[model samples]
Target: MAFPLKFTLVTALLLLAACRSDPIQFHTLTPAQVGDHSRTTVGVIQIESISVPPQVDRAQIVIRQGNSGLAILETEWWGATLVDELNSALADQLSNYPAQSGYSVRVDVQRFDSVPGQYALMDVKWRLRSAGESEPARVICRSTLQTPSGPSIDELVLAQQNNIKRLAALISQAAARKQAGCLMPVN
Candidate 1:
């Protein structure tokens, strides 16, 4: 009877251990803390739309392997939808620019991928239109931002955030040029 009880207890413990899983972590692309606080405020900018690739539209972090494969990290997740996070970050980055009227920005992300120990890349086509404008100015931006990473996902996220910030800066510059009547034709 004693032996049977001990065996049952051991089996229960093993089962419990096998069923346990590591807690999942959620992350977001937030704006960088460092900024020019003294910069003048820009008029409100609305993110009209943000579209991402279907492969990366899910909550999990998708990683591009080589030419032919991808990996979705099951334990890692975005704090919100990827589009929402990118839009929020872009808005935050552009808040400092001064503008008299609201502007609308649209972003279509073609590629967003992170490779561990390598780089994070974002290829995007974006449009900016001032209030009541008949046409929007468009540009395609490609960023390959690099960062050092160990076996952790945090570094990859940081790199991606940086790339988004860079894109926002480009948009802000383009908006300023447009306001100054020096807008360039999209290529």
Candidate 2:
């Protein structure tokens, strides 16, 4: 009886070890190194907020299908929370500008959808306010950056990185225009 109990305990331990999975690999998105060489000096642009939907705010990558179904990839995760990663990427992207001027930016991410082997889509509403301005300028930007995923999560992450780069470019352009007094007041 003692031998049987010991064997059962050893079997359970072996099964538990076998069922253990390798640690999940985490990934991060980085800002593009390219800068606007035309501008010698850029203003201080502060990121006020970066908000995402609850489904995508967590560390796990959320893949959505149509309107209802969604899958959270447990094996693949962001290096940090999605919002933090985005904030870091955006701040890094804007760091190329000179810090002479002052501007505040706020972003509301409506959709951050990724489809393996297909495309990555990002739709965002953003606001920019120059220092001392009473109201901010608002814009809606959307990008359906496409890349052959090769059925890999790395490719999906790459697509997301590209989309973020595009968004940063748009925001930079807007900031340049505002700095140059090219943009008229919406009101």
Candidate 3:
């Protein structure tokens, strides 16, 4: 009968609609276009280790909803873990330092806050030491890098990217000079 056929068709359509879900979106911290490589250095920069906060170290990007709330985005994910993303991004950017002093950097992220339509903030404690040196100049510094972002997810990622770029620059400069001790907080 036409009634039975119509009911079956409606059920099939409902099933199809229920099965459709939004595709997962993956993002990365890698720069779209790398900078010039003409800086000629003695050795390459090695990102020794990167440690992010437990709250934001997963594949999904965590956003600070308010003063004390955190929202984990299920559908949006990073290409890799948060630590891996930082290691890759820092290695990529620091490779261009014009300094001859090769060094290794270790970063411990105390707080990685991402807020939609507000800002992306990175509060990290980073250390740099010369490579292959018996007594290397060890420098430890903490920096709070913040960048304004738009409401979109892409904009938030871009903001975080900018923070990474700035951190790379600071590490590059520090390694170049071979600081003897801890420095003040950078901007």
The best candidate in terms of lDDT: 3
Better of 2 and 3 by lDDT: 3
Candidate 3 C-alpha lDDT tens digits along 133-161: 57454788888999999998899999999
Candidate 2 lDDT over residue span 26-140, tens digit each = 9888744564645433574778899998879898988866668899999899999999999987777676554445777788888888887677777777776665557555443
CA shift of 43, model 3, Å: 1.7
lDDT of 3 at 144: 90
Candidate 3 weakest ten by summed lDDT:
178-187
Q: What is the Å distance of residue 6 in model 3 from its true position?
A: 2.1
Q: Which stretches of candidate 3 lie over 4 Å from their true place?
A: 34-42, 133-137, 178-187
lDDT of 1 by residue, 40-152 (tens): 55585667889999999988899988887999988999998898888888777777555556667878888887888787778777767775567555443443334444446
Q: So what's the TM-score on candidate 1?
A: 0.82
43: Cα error in model 1, Å: 0.3
